[model samples]
Target: MIKLIAIDLDDTLIAPDGHLPEENVTALAQAQEAGVQVVIATARGYAGTKRFHDQLGLTTPLIVSSGSNVIEGRSGEVLRRRFLPLPFAREVVAFAQAHQIALRVYVGNEVWNNLDYDPSNGRQRTVEKQVEQMAEALVEAPFQIFVKGNRESELILAQFGEAGEGYCCRHHVYSDGISELNILHPKSTKHDALAGLCAALDVPQEQVMALGDSKNDLGMIAWAGFGVAMSWASEAVRAAADWVVPADAQRLTSDPDAEVAEAVLRHVLHVAKDKKSS
Candidate 1:
């Protein structure tokens, strides 16, 4: 029987507007009632994603910072942490400067920006504004803002790739349809974090399932026993997923993002139940 469900937040569990739908919440509660562990794995940092956890009523561990850190979801206690070295961090900063890209740096839940000029990297520039908006929301919401960037992310990724995943490097496009730095420790990833959680929970990888809708989720999707992709996910994500969940029919939601997620969640939960019965 499946013992764990590692879900991605942004486009997987939560709707695009950053709220969990009623159907999705009901599904989670049912999963819990059925004795399945529901966990969150996302690129969001502890301070950034904690509110969602509370809203979802998750009692399990969280894989945050794209697996850079693992912590208790309800209590907000750190279980494990991996961070990039200062030298490597500086290299990433230098590379962004050299490439004329704006960057947002994340260091242990603190977000810093060195944008002398506004961001100028095509779609990434749009992401910069989303980052700013998220930061602004945090100020009023009493949460942490890890970092925001308005620099060339390609340059940042070039450096991160050079440094390799060994430094816990990750790069993902932000919500505004632009790329941003989603860097983390080399060993820190949803895959590694799930493995760690599995070990702690005495569950094997073959018994774990994962659901997601983004490129950053590829690792966990690949790691899961069943990797279910959302219907509205990017082609790249869909191509990698083991199965695809259809969109929901009930269109109570008006937001496009939330609607897509609700559809996926509704379908994926059905899939999960089918798996258990099978």
Candidate 2:
């Protein structure tokens, strides 16, 4: 029996228009009622993921910042956090300056972003305090560092990623055609964080289900005993999934993007229904 579910938010659970689909809402509520743990695992901050946790009435810890930060849901306690080491973080700041690469750095709850505030363009919220000099604002080691643009830039971040400098890297592109590489502590993966949460909850890996759509989600999806990938996910991601949401799963949701509803309902809940009927 699947007892825990880790769900990615941006492209998997939330539609492009930014609304949670009606069917998804219903299915998650039913899952919670069925005593299954519904966890929101996203590459966003706690401030960004909290509203959904509240809406779903989930009491589980939230995996945020692509697993860099895990916080208790109800009391907002810091369950676990792995931040970039200060020396490496300072090195990153200097390197960004040298390459003129834009940076978004997280220092605890405060953020230092060089980008303009444009929520209309799908940018992170305006809560990020605009900073001209990253070195000046980065008082503490960052939980995550977002380097604008994809492709390794002259090995600036290779030390952290490919070179294995105690950090992990992820490449992601937004719907607006902008791409970024997120750098964080080496253990900062949804899979690693989920493993910790499962241990705490006493849920075996075999009883954990994970759903997602992006390559960043690949770790958790591949690690979960029963992994679900959206039908439109890349071939690599799909290959890792235990069950890829079929093309017909789109019909299970009014919002084409909330295919998670189908995975949750048919694969998770339908079994319960059948057992009761039997």
Candidate 3:
């Protein structure tokens, strides 16, 4: 039986502006009231995602920095962590330097970038504008403008290839056409985090329902018994999902939050309720 519901942040669960609609907020309350576990498995770190839990007034634990760590959202206690080996960490940094690509590293909740590539540099006026726009879009983001480098796409790929499961990488296309990449240790994936959460809660993967809308979310989507793709998810995301909500991104944005939340709630709650009834 399903005993837990894991939601992704970003475009899947939050508005484009980074705020949870009142309707979604209420739906979360209903899930909690039903005694079903409600939690988030996100790419965000503890500091970045805490506000979502707070906004919903939820006290459940959170899986942050992908699956690299599980934390107590309220107390900020790290319940568990999986870190990259020291050698691997150093290699990743070196690869970025070699390729002349910008790299952002997440060691715990802190982001470290190469000194020369810091986003604050006046030389990166174009990249800086994109960052500014994203910051405005999300209202809040985890990065704090650390070191930066020239675009080194080749080196970044090599790092991930050599690093293997030792680390994870996320590629983002900036509005300025610059590609920004982030790398973290292996455990920092939604799949691993979801597995970790299942173990902690004594819920089987077959009993979990996950919702997402991006490539980073692929692992968890495949890992869950029921994977939901948003209405506006990419074709790859839709292909990976067990079910697709007819509502795409535009529809979700234009439709009421309550409507979107209700669609998600019905599917997840049905799974949770039926397992118990069985």
Candidates arranged by TM-score, highest first: 2, 3, 1
In model 2, the runs with Cα more than 4 Å from the true position are 114-133, 136-139, 150-163, 249-255, 271-278
| lDDT tens digits by residue: candidate 2, 1-278 | 78999999987888656778877888898898998999999998888788999988898999998998889988778899998888888788777766566677888767776555422223555635767676766677888877655543335546555435677667666775656678889899898999999999999999999999888789999999899998878888899999998876325445566688878887778744344355
lDDT per model vs. reference: 0.64, 0.79, 0.63
lDDT of residue 194 for candidate 3: 79
Q: Model 1 has how many clashing residue pairs?
A: 18
lDDT of candidate model 2 versus the reference: 0.79
Residue 81, candidate 2: alpha-carbon lDDT: 94
RMSD of each: 7.5, 3.6, 8.1
Candidate 2: the clashing residue pairs are none
Candidate achieving higher lDDT, 2 or 3: 2
lDDT of 3 by residue, 198-264 (tens): 8877988887778877777888888888887776667888899887776533232234533336445
Number of backbone collisions per candidate? 18, 0, 18
Q: Candidate 1 on 143-209: residue-level lDDT in tens?
A: 1112234344555545455236446444556577655555555676788888889999998887787
Q: Is candidate 1 or candidate 2 better by TM-score?
A: 2
Alpha-carbon shift of residue 118 in model 1 (angstroms): 11
